[model samples]
Target: MGKDLILQAGRRTITMETAAVAALEARVDDSFHRACELMLGCSGRVIVSGMGKSGHIGRKIAATLASTGTPSFFVHPGEASHGDLGMITRHDVVIAISNSGSSAEVLTLLPLLKRLGIPLISMTGKTDSPLAQSADVNLDIAVETEACPLNLAPTSSTTVTLVMGDALAVALLEARGFTAEDFAFSHPGGALGRQLLLKVADVMHAGEELPQVSPETPLSKALLEMTSKGFGMTTIVDSNGQLLGVFTDGDLRRVIDQKLELDTATMEQVMSRRPKTVSAHTLAAEALRIMEDNKITALVVEDPEHHPIGLLHMHDVLRAGVI
Candidate 1:
């Protein structure tokens, strides 16, 4: 085959898949809506099962549903015939995926599923197939052509089926009013989780680790506290422990330019008044945004009363996976 022919075929495959997905858009009729309703009303998890390529897609759909606030899991239809059907319960809804909708492994479990009164949702390219006819809800995933040049291999058909699954998961996700915070709870080990759920209080250095100085403290003495605290900055507070100003290396450079006596110059005299501050209750992601927008590396964590309770540096949020 010519190289250009291969390239042309590849582009054709992508076009075919796109058209298949477009066809699915119009196929989302009452049957599609009923399938979503069955899943939404299910008291137990939606069990997705299939064989071969359909099985792989089923597993992905199950995972997507689970992560998006819909309770779900995947089961192998072949395994169900061999005693795994015990995992299926009357409270659960079964979603069987097959392009032909008549795989023997799936057909073998039909009677058992019916006996248990489990509602069945069938996703298939053939509405007349056995699985769709037996199902409580049939979602027709028809495709005009296969992306496969030979027209036998599953291609555009599978792509449209997977997209349909995504549509269902997202619809359920919105119907359930799933929030970013709720999604973050399901993914607590990644940066996304930290960004949405982690608070400034969770990452800030408190008490002895916080570098603070009174407004009247000598600039030289405040620098000592800054270096010891290892934050390269110190918050200047009043006698009442309320934040008054902030002192950093930027202030140090200006203080030196003014030829000020370090022993006589107080922190308040050299500090930047009304500097950026964040509440401990704020999300760590918000702190990162503030730092990026302000071009700074550190944030003072204040309490409700505007008192500096802790210090949060860029490294702190980075280490906590907020980066």
Candidate 2:
């Protein structure tokens, strides 16, 4: 009705849900452990099913589990009855979500799951409901009250269900020793995947694109190389093409401050020696960290013998979405 009343309602809802989530910590007891064990031991995919709002949470839980190394997918309880039940297999495990724990559509699938000897796990608000009683392991998702002022809508209960799903996914992820690389594989199209999977060689400018000059080269020539390569820097190499140092825009400023003749200056005299370097095999994400920590824009990608093979620019990493 009024602005104060609307704000008060929103705050009250958040406060109630926050308390409900806190209560979930205590419920993560033996039952939670057993559920994780069951899912971990599943030889096939973990099948998740529910109805209405619970179904929405079930789909997210399945997605989280699948991304974190646990193979899973969501199936609507209503659809499962209409030939979709064929999707479930004897080797798989089932996680059913229903606040009342008596959803008839979900209950109908129990007999079939039992016939196949599939492990049954239930997240329910009522421990004594049929679904809970039938499950091999029951996770208590019961909340004290709904966040709705009427105490009728599935508000606090749904939030608790989603959080419980996250806890289960994270726990199983750690138990399975799932790594960031593993997650990247599951999400190859995202920025996070690029960060974790891309190597310096994959994003670095190599071959003809690398800006390099010999130590004996004039500062003017090195500056031209830096400009042509668009890297804002050029590597100084020895006769054998081994990295000796680097000349950058920053060096140009210093040379100007000293009133040196750009034409008379040599790469060896003006270059910053022993510049920071990264191997081509290094992770692009790690290379970004190196640049940020050292306050540098570029890194010389070197071979084992310190030969300049490529140039890794911060822009290159960002372009590849490593950040």
Candidate 3:
């Protein structure tokens, strides 16, 4: 193939991948609903099982389920006959995946899977296979053909199975009212988790580390506080600790060019009075957006009544990986 032909073939691969996922949409029926209901009804984890290529897809599906607010784990069927059958329990739900529904190792576990009193959800290309017939709910994951030239590789089958898994997981998620916060709890170190769960209060410098000054504080004194705190800005607050505004190094430079008396000028006279503030409970990523929009580097975290509680700096947001 020519270079252009090769590029067209690569694009065709994505088309095939997308079409494989799209095919599972038509299979969402009462059986799909029953499968979701069965999995949701379980008190223990969803145990995904398969062999060979399906094993790899099953692991990915289990991970998707777990991250999307469902408790799930993948167990290799071959290992189950060897000793891993102990991992299955009466309270657990088993999702057996076999493109042909006749994989020996997967078939080997079904009888014991039934003995455990666990509900079975089967994903297979053939709905009439023994595994599918035995399942409490059968999810059809058939596809048109594989991307492999001879239709021998598991490409299309794997894609449809994954899409079915995602559908089940999302359905369960919605039924349980699982919000972004719930998903974040499961993935505390992931970017999505940080964006949803990390609050200004969690990342802000609070208590003694917060650099602050009063509106009446002299410009020189405010500058000293800002320099010592290393936040590039210090909040100016009133007697009740309500934020009045902010004074920063940039403001000082402008005041100097205007020849304003640093010692005589109060921060209230030189500060940016219309400063932006965020609630301590706001997400850190949201705070980063507010800062980027306002073209400012620091924000004072305020209480519901608008009193300053902490300082959120750009450097801290960067360190937290919000950027």
Candidate 4:
């Protein structure tokens, strides 16, 4: 086949699925609201079950729901028949997905689910199908046609099902007032977690690692502290440990431009006064933004009292994966 023909085929598939999703948007009725209400009111997790391609979509939906503050997980319909059905409790809610709403594996569990008195939310293409008719709430995910050329494979139908799952997850997320910090708690090892949950104090150089010098200290001594600490900068403070200013490599270059002798100049005379400072409790990502916006590489981490307690450099942010 020609390359252009392959590209055209891909475009047609996307167009078909896009139309299918747009149609699903119009069909979001009271049943969708009832499903969300049931899920929100569930004392146990949302148990999602499906067969074949629908199972794959259910797994993703369950994961999204769990990460967005709704406790949920997927159970394969085949596995549910074998023993996994015990995982479902009456306090939980079940969302069963089937393109035709007549999968034998899914239908087999209906009687048991009803016996348990658990709520069932059905997602299917056929409103009159066995699974939909047996469910407590039926969500129609019908598509006019399949994206597959033969109209046999589940394409547009599955896309609509996935979108409907997202709609339910986001509605529950908003109803629960889930915040990014809560999402970070569920994904502590992910990049978003590092950006939102990691604080500057967690990564900044503190105590002996903090490079500091007295305002009256000679610039040469401050340079020694900068070299020893390997932070490329030094914070200048008073006897009370109050921040007086900061001296960085850029300040060194400026001093060199003025032809001033490092041994004779005091830090207070050569340092950049009132250099950018951030609280130790500030988020590392916010610190990174302040550094990027000011085009600076280092910031002094202070307490609420304005006393310099630590130092943060760009490398620390990079090491923490906040950059």
Highest-TM-score candidate: 1
Model 3, position 233: C-alpha lDDT score: 87
Query: Global CA lDDT of candidate 3, please?
Result: 0.88
TM-score, per-candidate, Cα-based: 0.97, 0.94, 0.91, 0.96
- Two-way TM-score contest, 2 vs 4, winner: 4
The 10-residue segment with the lowest total lDDT in model 1: 19-28
Question: How are the candidates ranked when ordered by TM-score, highest leading?
Answer: 1, 4, 2, 3
Worst 10 residues of 4 by lDDT: 20-29
Each prediction's whole-model lDDT (CA): 0.91, 0.95, 0.88, 0.93
Instruction: Tell me the deviation in Å of residue 55 in model 1.
Output: 0.7
**Tens-digit per-residue lDDT, 1-323, candidate 3:** 79998988778877997988877788899998898889878899999999988999999999989988778999999889999999988999999999998898999988887887789999999989988998988899888888766789888788888788888888998999998888889988878878888889889998988888988898888889988988888988899888888888788889989999989999889999868889988999999999899888889888888888899998899899776
Residue 135, candidate 3: C-alpha displacement in angstroms: 0.9
Worst 10 residues of 3 by lDDT: 142-151
Higher-lDDT candidate among 1 and 4? 4
Error of 3 at 241 (Å): 2.5
Note the residue pairs that clash in candidate 3.
Answer: none
Against the true structure, whose lDDT is highest?
2
Candidate 1 lDDT over residue span 1-323, tens digit each: 99999999889888889888987888778888899999989999999999999999999999999999988999999988888888889999999999998999998888999999999999988999999999998899878778887889999888988999999999999999999988989898877888999999999999999888998899889989989988889998888889998999888998899999999999878999998989988999999999999999999888888899998899989988887
